[model samples]
Target: SGSTQCDKLTSEKTELTVTPKELTLTTENITATAGTTTTLTATFNDDTLNTGKVVFKVNGKTVKDENGKVIYAKVVNGQVSVEYTLPESMKAGNYTITAVYTSPNSEKLTAEATLTVAKASNN
Candidate 1:
């Protein structure tokens, strides 16, 4: 061979780290009747990551929707639970309830449950 050339190179690389998936609500399907109360509970797979300061919303409404209102909600040991009291005056129908959770890392997540309101019985 008249001429030859060779080259060698080496480099260091850094990898980016990503956080694990946050907690989520795993409960759905709720049934109730007019003039009665229903309690729905949702459990999170990763409880340690979720703590105080979780927000709950129904049909994009903070307090009262076009039809109903949220009675109460609380987070206990990484599980977010809510109790909704359907007013006796409310018309029987189907409603969609949602729970929006804000993680400590400022990530927004949502959980949904279906609420079926049965007609009041004539007694």
Candidate 2:
């Protein structure tokens, strides 16, 4: 039996390179009253690729949406700011908020912020 033979071919591939920029995260308030709206901002210098894809989590849960969905805020000028009202039932304690930014090349950076929830006074 005669069979057609194929030649093996090999080519060199180049790895694209990019410079990483420092990503910073901050919030308008380190403390908030129960059921009050607060804001958190994540900034990336010259990070046009992953700025819009930033995801924020509060106490291990995503922040945003009326139904408490995982989508919140939007990217503008290499930054995404999220405004959310604290849960009324939230206990008076320290809470954690985290923001993660992942690049197109799969490189990721994460930053965290703390929020102190004050108990509502029964005045």
The best candidate in terms of lDDT: 2
- For model 2, name the residue pairs that clash: none
lDDT of 1 at 89: 78
> Which lDDT tens digits does candidate 1 get at residues 37-122?
67666667776644644445545555343366543344567686666667787677877777666655666667777778888888
**lDDT by residue for model 2 (26-86), tens:** 4433788888888777776554634446678888887768975776455567778777788
**Per-prediction TM-score, please?**
0.65, 0.67
Query: Which residue runs does candidate 1 get wrong by more than 4 Å?
Result: 1-19, 63-74
RMSD values for the candidates in order, in angstroms, are: 9.5, 8.4
